[model samples]
Target: MKNNPVNTDLPLFCPREGCVCYQSYDNKITKDGIYITKSDMVPRQMFYCHGGGHRFSETGYSELFGKHGSFKEYEQAAKLSTYGISANATADVLGRDVRTVEQWQKALGSKGQQLHYFLCLHIGINVLFLQMDELWSYFKNKSRQLWVFIALESETKFWVSFELGSRTICTACRLVKGLRRLGKWGDDHILKVTTDKSAAYKNALANIMGDIQYAYLQIVKRRVKRRLVTVKKFFVKGMAEDFSEKLRTPPLLRD
Candidate 1:
């Protein structure tokens, strides 16, 4: 058996659940051997975790683990999905079965959720300006209405938080509360929030961030025949001068 060399750049951990050293950085992990799958014809490294008394592949604890198909195909499918392509359409384009595409979507979505939680959630971010809005969507039919509430940082264009549910106060509260948890405010920092004129948002902000020093702006748009005719801005909280100074010169444009 040819013993494969372990990559030092990547941390090795025992992925076995319930093991004492599970997910811990341990030196007991050693490269065991290499195996090539018939589908990809690529040599994959395997490792032995002496602490867990088990052997696993390098792809363990990752989306690629136990996947028999080419990584490129999976990536292409995910990219197509992000581009608003339906799974059935992606299957036809990739010459794959619809079920296979759906399975890949589920696996990729799970991995994406895990990554988002680790990278975004529970992390403190100093947000100077934020934009909050809800997009209308539906599931299967129009009768089943769904809303996607999203909060984004204006300067970095970073997606701060999101919630999916009905367009109601409960969903709005969840979104605002999530922002309150992730946001780190200083003594002089004043968060500026812009959103469409929605009563739910106003109430949710009052309930979640009442004590926090923040400026809230509501933009009410009047549409004639589905075309925007006019837009009116209203400051629901904080001084108008504060928002005027921040809006006039965004962080990116300032020295």
Candidate 2:
């Protein structure tokens, strides 16, 4: 197949933060030329920012910037890494050095974090029901225990917030505070929360969500030798009968 000509319809802007037209939609950017790299043998489009007197490529501010490899190769490595494949195994599958895969993974992870913050931070959403939980993990060795506290919106199953720390009330408070910042609820709207039988969550919700009208439930599970015996539920804040009625006919399902 023949190489396609550059499309001028793309929304290009000055990426330099100090530039006058940074992120502006004005017609201050123009195509400079095309450059071909040996690694991918593909032509990359370059542009000039007249407002900032800066020059950059199409891949500027991206994870693939200044990377010497095919885009498909980097994408495949990221996909494999997400599937729990080790960097060494990914290098063997792609016929590349393990160090290169590791570098790509780090770069991709940084870019992912930036994107996630840009999209999720302070962007409030309507959350009626939320569930809080924690997962135990370790770093380097089993002795160094770590916990991941997570809050999920029950109806949409969207991850509202998370914190990495010890399984303490401090971490739980941070998680709930983040949820408060990201959720939009009115005084009349009663936010329902469910969590395991952890006193930390109880204190956190009570402290951080005191002003908001909400219902809290704790699920207690009895286990003998890792085998479940009985399960019980307790309401800590709102009335149990009201909470159960709301659960049976959730706000989203109401006519």
Candidate 3:
């Protein structure tokens, strides 16, 4: 198959901040020719930051450089791995070596983490109806209990934030505090929050109310004689809003 340019013909610039090499988007940057190779003869665009004489590549900080395959190949492996395929299997399917697949996977993961940090710190998400839940599992001969606290934005269905600790109020607070950076809260912007009837969620969210402003609700499920009973909607914090009417009882997956 024919190979394309590393950055898909996008204008390349030095990612370094305060570097004049970025230019004013009008000044022409000096093309320093290809800097590296991967699989075919993938040309890496090189530019010299005239101000600092700092040179950078079109694939600077890109996940495509270190791996044996091209950026497209890395993406293909990632797509197949999503379907429960292992690195080795994806490598075989892609006709690339297994180590190359592993490198691409790690590079993809690092890129995701970097993006998440940028969003969490620089870009705040204003979410309405953030669903909170925790799943329980035991590890090491069932001696250690592992609880994963998850906060999901119902409107956009984005996994807003998460924390890992025992099902304790302290851990819940840590997760809620992280939500403050995620985005603003209001019905006009952010609205109600949903969570199963967990005392920890109530206490933690209440404590953070003075800091992050938003309405909260709880979905309490009751079972009688091992039979499914009534699912009660209860107010956990703040005055209920109009969207509360839209809150529906979700099917119980498991305890």
Candidate 4:
């Protein structure tokens, strides 16, 4: 004789952007009894209610963890997946494949590229505050390093030029290219550029600003506490004395 199993119920989550709450339901019924389960038991396809009516279909879920799949499911898994939790651990908890976890990471990378593009395209304003910093990544075992150079208006916070770079020269070049892209590369456009005492930055600034006969600019170096010798500041005083008056005030906030 064949042994029969009992019926079952499962819990489900709405794989939407900002939805919460789990609904419980019965999955199957058999000779034994009933059992419960979760909705994320499988990949959920979502749909939108377009037009004036409520019509929904299996569209797709945003890659909260990756390019596609349930956002909540991945988030739930990510929290556990880190701190030495194996991929299998997360997969089992979320009822997903270990491969899916990797895919999510890839999707996040793609999104970062998109953000970088946007930061480059939209830049405006009078003053620019360029900063260089690094972000640490545990998975890569190395820091995700970058130089963020931006040309921004001091008052309105409008960005004129922004670039993310891996190399100092590349970063400097991007700063130049970004300014050119906004049609603000001329001598009169830049009021001041505050930066650290990087030789690449100094060389790049001189290359760009020195060409103009009318633009006066200064490069101020913020000192590191532990360093004994303070870094020297670089400035290009152009022919225009009127714009030079605005150079006295420091652009960055004191920390």
Candidate 5:
């Protein structure tokens, strides 16, 4: 029984995602005594709903669980991992198996990703002003390099979409495509996209912004040694101008 029990004062809905129980649905859930565990003699709460014959437990969805550890242990394992503690250390601290901690971490991560996607789906059309950037990281001993392309809605400061791949034109295209699917662009619906001076950015924006109304610009920072540097703007798309003219009006350069 290594499942995290949800602390709830009321059985809000059927734990099953496919269940059609309404909030107003009369689910007279009655407690059917308890089952005492043989090992610890801990009494587990059991519930039964007459509607749909839905039966569940306090520590589980539809049955008694948590044979090994409780939800607190699962939460502790998750928090330990978040605090820069490795899986082995988290397991040692929680007195749980290392593999169990790892599995909980993965499940929590997947739930977080699902929540993020759910929030993204609820973002209205008002979310505009796109910012694109790449984060470079290595796996384990730097054996495999991973490039994460992140697109942010600058105005709302909300994450639009992200893609994991090598820093390439195809990856950039995929990232842009992900952002474009979020909302409509062009004409009355304006979008200002800002990014660093990466060739992939140019290719991606050019390929996507053919009919869309968007202003794209690259922020170019000229480095002198390892000290402070000067910044300039390079126009990419939505508006056409000579390189010299584009540099003159930095404020007007960005859409």
Candidate 6:
């Protein structure tokens, strides 16, 4: 791939932030498709220089650089589909073919699934609440089911995590693994993780976080009520307004 001309006066750096090359703090060039860090760790050229840690790219870089269009679009498309919008619907909004959308979705794979799940999980994690439930449904009579456990931060009303399962400990472990992979587990960042007194989550947290912190909330009506209320009051209602009309509504409201 042809690279855009590098700005020598400013100098380009590695793309990865935590990479040893960026940490070198020197004028490094791509040599033999490798970037030699200060410690002499040879990382690939692609990982070099994270657009200099500001905008992630300079003006005209989009047209002048990168292998493809923005990954942000793909992230948005995945979120839409995961949150109940069909892939075709996302394709329409993104101005891409349905198959292309599916291709992006596939390209994202587990990482994409984790990213979309973050929105769901973050909503529950920050709220100081726990709710567990087993939901059952059938698509063409083929039992499509889910076991969902949520850890909520009641104070901020944000999600800690949404651990989804196929009603098994193995899947629960997978959810925990996903959280760890996302760098959420075993971190002091989360204040309190709560879930319905499930041994699986409790055990998983214990294993990962070393008895860090948690609360066990019973499956109660008001917990869910509060969640629904938060969602409707914040996300749903906020998104429901027609921005075009709302921008025009202040004069009407005053009248």
Best by TM-score: 1
Tell me the tens digit of each residue's lDDT in model 1 across 1-255. 023553336477788777888988864899999988765666778999888788888677776676656677888988998898999999999888898888888888888776665545433356788878888888879999899888888766678788999999999999999877765743478888888889999999889888888888887777687666776889898767767764732222111
TM-score of each: 0.81, 0.75, 0.70, 0.41, 0.64, 0.43
lDDT of 5 by residue, 1-255 (tens): 023453334444445444555333466666867876543345777766666577666655422244455556656766877687988898888777888777777766665665566555543344446778888866666879988888876644567788999989999999988877766676575567778889998888889866777777787756577443677777776554322232332321121
> Which of the predicted structures, 1 or 5, would earn the higher TM-score when compared with the native?
1
Give the alpha-carbon lDDT of every model.
0.77, 0.77, 0.71, 0.47, 0.66, 0.43
lDDT ranking, high to low:
1, 2, 3, 5, 4, 6
Model 2 residue 171 CA deviation in Å: 1.6
3 or 5, which is superior by TM-score? 3
Model 6 per-residue lDDT tens digits across residues 120-208: 44322222222223344344356665555443334343344456656566655666655544334324432333333346755565566
Q: Which candidate would rank higher by lDDT, 1 or 6?
A: 1
Error of 6 at 91 (Å): 2.7
What tens-digit string does per-residue lDDT give for candidate 3 at 12-100? 44566676655355444677777656464667678776555777777665665556677667678768776758888998888877887
lDDT of candidate 2 at residue 64, scale 0 to 100: 69
- Locate the minimum summed-lDDT window of 10 residues in model 4: 21-30
Global local distance difference test of model 5: 0.66
Q: How many backbone clashes does candidate 4 have?
A: 29
Local accuracy of candidate 2 as per-residue lDDT tens digits, 122-170: 3335677787888887877999999989887776657778899998999
Where in model 6 is the C-alpha error above 4 Å?
A: 1-13, 16-79, 92-95, 106-142, 146-152, 157-164, 177-193, 197-199, 202-210, 222-255
Candidate 4's C-alpha runs over 4 A off are: 1-68, 73-99, 115-127, 132-171, 174-189, 206-232, 236-255
Ten-residue region with minimum lDDT total, candidate 2:
246-255
For model 1, the local distance difference test gives 0.77
Can you give the lDDT of residue 174 in candidate 5? Answer: 97
